[model samples]
Target: MPLDLNKLDHLIAVAEEGSLTRAAARLHLSQQALSTSVRTLEREVGVRLLERTSGGVTLLPSGAALVEDARVLRGVAQSALRRARRIGRGEREMLRIGHTPAVTGGEVSLLLRHVAVTDPELAADAHQRYPGELTAGLLAGDLDLGLCRGMSPAHGLARAVLGEHRISIGVAADHPLAGRESVALADLSEQTLVVWGRPGDSGYTDLLVGHCRAAGFEPRLERSTLQGTPPVTHVIGTDRVAFLTEPPGAAAGGAVRVLALQPPVFVPLHALYAPHLASTNRDAFLDAAQARASRHA
Candidate 1:
């Protein structure tokens, strides 16, 4: 049965204080009002929860059991109210965010720092997923926003192109192409291309294929899992060239080199959300993300 927590609290106070007059004074209610509240609760629960004596009041067996259960329920109700108030004050409770492999740590950290400054009570969490999985999470309501590259066309989701980043090729430092300051699409025509086929990322894959085919020869495709630090491993050990952004740096331990693509292929970074789930906090995050992307771009 649904319980009225206010009445439950009054009952607990009266039981603890052992006197109607004292309980009423502590609760800021008159004795008559306190008596009415107790009687009403008893009617609703179909049990006489208190035994009144000349000296004070005491709990019956059912009253003792209800008091114990009410203590737990009261705590839960208070916590729920606190969270609700925090939410009303502006994204100060919990914010769920999803990101793709391409979303850099710097980008996510920027947003986290902004939220900490603006709403210190906000607790932000990040879930790392492939571009496809991020998109799916946003649509399924598992995530409030997504940092991703390309996504399939869906009317249920709204996406903004946060910024465009220059595309580069990742190769072993010893590879011939790695020695060049910059390499054109034509330069990679004869080399094996390593690309991971992330689920729901067909649009991005198609773009890569179209760009390579335009250079006159089909790419020799080699696939691998792009999760975690696998990209560094693939570029370091393989003869195939992997595409990257801004190129590999010291994180590759000098084993990898990032060469700019001639003519400069620029890929768009996206911020995706469901229009129905939009909020001031979400919009603020999008604005900050876009600004950061511009700085990096």
Candidate 2:
């Protein structure tokens, strides 16, 4: 028997909500009905999917893996329907691009400008999304492409490195290192590092931390209180220093100074997309981006 899409959706809901009651409420179905659907799905797959406990439900390894693929399947179905409707209406295709905060709006615009030079007729839309949201949007077919730095693509997604950006250091104008033209990794050993996300939780953060560790010191990391702001701005009012890609200059109205990193470190800019979905616009944009990156290299 073919796997039922509805049953898969039910399982996804249960996995997300972690409780049959809540999942059923969200789906507007009775708890018993939702439970039965999940059980049926498990039986069809010939494996136990969930572990029931007094607290709530937890996904077994197989269930977790199935949920990942189920999301991709649902997205493919939705994308197919959307494409059919667009074709029926004679609507032109527009590439939808989502990017994480780490990539910055300026970077996206720069890439788009490069794409325009190569494919002037391609219509595109770009917006910033959190890392999780970016992944979900790509998996749900809401975004045709996603741009990020150091983000590991989730299941059902593929990534390509477009290019690398040099890392710089940012410090408040009044900070001790503000007068320096450039600073080595060892110079930051004693300074508290302001990071956008928790060290272990964000791949970008981990990459930065790894650099610091390689320099022979465990970094003292502080999560920035100001979220979604430019990395250079994170050091504006604090005594902390930040790893930034922002060009060297006075930022936050001259409150911060951006300095070059000696023995330069670089981070890769990656493009993420659902490989199974074919879009001429996406292909064109990627090709243009790669060509531009090659020229820069």
Please, what is the whole-model Cα lDDT of each candidate in the order they appear?
0.73, 0.90
TM-score of each: 0.60, 0.96
Write the residue-wise lDDT of candidate 1 on 1-297 in tens digits: 677888998998998899999999999999999999999999999989999999999999989988866755654455456556767887453567887666665657766785466455556688777766775566555677787666653546778887776788888888877767888898887887776663335556666777788877778776665555545456786687887774534437788888878887877777788665534557777776667666776
Best-fitting candidate, scored by lDDT: 2
TM-score for candidate 1: 0.60
Model 2 TM-score, all chains together: 0.96
